[model samples]
Target: MADSDQSSTDSPVDSREDSIQDSKLDKFSEDEETLITMMFNLVGERWSLIAGRIPGRTAEEIKKYWTSKYSSSE
Candidate 1:
């Protein structure tokens, strides 16, 4: 019973560590993708313009979403 309790506590911490490592790995994988890099390079800095063109995408709305997203990830 004591062993099971210890394992349970460790399990969540291990899972969290794995998720953090996975996120870093995913970022590295994204860096290797040429097409995605190109699109991000072209449109990332100009969220407003992209938002304007895409239907249902408003500049302010996109800005807020991206801001929250990038902020949380960092």
Candidate 2:
């Protein structure tokens, strides 16, 4: 039915939005921050490598956190 089709299409979009919201709401813990620093020192901006070491984190999220915390604004 059309209603079922519409609901199925909406499900993916809703889940994607929920995941985005969840990622935004989540903060890096102290241990995660320490791990990120250590990984950066070892790999030097290889975000995917660092992300592989951290559970439940993506490379993009790691890079954004690192840049926001460490990169100068000049």
Candidate 3:
């Protein structure tokens, strides 16, 4: 009886961990998609010239800001 109870408890804990992993994976994919779109919008635009204005700003930082700002609305 003790072994059976332990097995049942462990199963749910494992499943919950899997759920968290899946959620994180989904968020990462969504962030990548948003970043790609933002990059396309900036292509051949004047933004490229001003990119250096924000010293040390990287593509990842730009993507994260836009994702946090825009993705929530979507």
Candidate 4:
């Protein structure tokens, strides 16, 4: 009973975070791939600099996206 109550309260916070991240990513999608490409080319893959231009996305997320996109497939 106590465990379930704690889980219920904690779940909403995690759900909210997921929704926030999704919304942020959605904003990036609106600008198209070209904008991101230009930023990356000029900024030199520096997430901190890129994040300034794109609101809501963090530096880490920027790096992660770049890695996943350019990573070599085996």
**RMSD to true structure for each model, in Å:** 9.8, 3.2, 10.7, 3.6
How many residue pairs clash in model 1?
Answer: 0
Which lDDT tens digits does candidate 3 get at residues 1-74?
99999989998999999887545444545645554456547763333333443444445444444455457543
Tell me the spans in candidate 4 whose CA falls farther than 4 Å from its real position.
Answer: 1-4, 15-27, 30-32
Using lDDT as the yardstick, the better of models 3 and 4 is 4
Question: Can you give the lDDT of residue 5 in candidate 1?
Answer: 96
Q: 1-74 in candidate 1: lDDT tens per residue? A: 99999988998999999787545434433333343335447877576665555455455544554454455553
Clashes of 3: 0
Best by TM-score: 2
Models ranked on TM-score: 2, 4, 1, 3
Alpha carbon lDDT of each predicted model = 0.56, 0.87, 0.54, 0.73
In model 3, residue pairs whose N, Cα or C atoms come closer than 3 Å (at least 3 residues apart or on different chains), thus clashing, are: none
Task: Count steric clashes of candidate 4.
Answer: 0
In model 1, residue pairs whose N, Cα or C atoms come closer than 3 Å (at least 3 residues apart or on different chains), thus clashing, are none
Report how far residue 74 has shifted in candidate 2, in Å: 4.4
Q: Which residues of candidate 1, in runs, are more than 4 Å off?
A: 1-40, 72-74
* Model 1 residue 67 lDDT score: 59
Q: Estimated TM-score per prediction?
A: 0.37, 0.67, 0.33, 0.60
- Candidate 2 lDDT over residue span 3-72, tens digit each: 9999899989999998885576358988999999999999899999999999988898898888877888
Which window of ten consecutive residues has the lowest lDDT sum in model 4? 24-33
TM-score of 1: 0.37
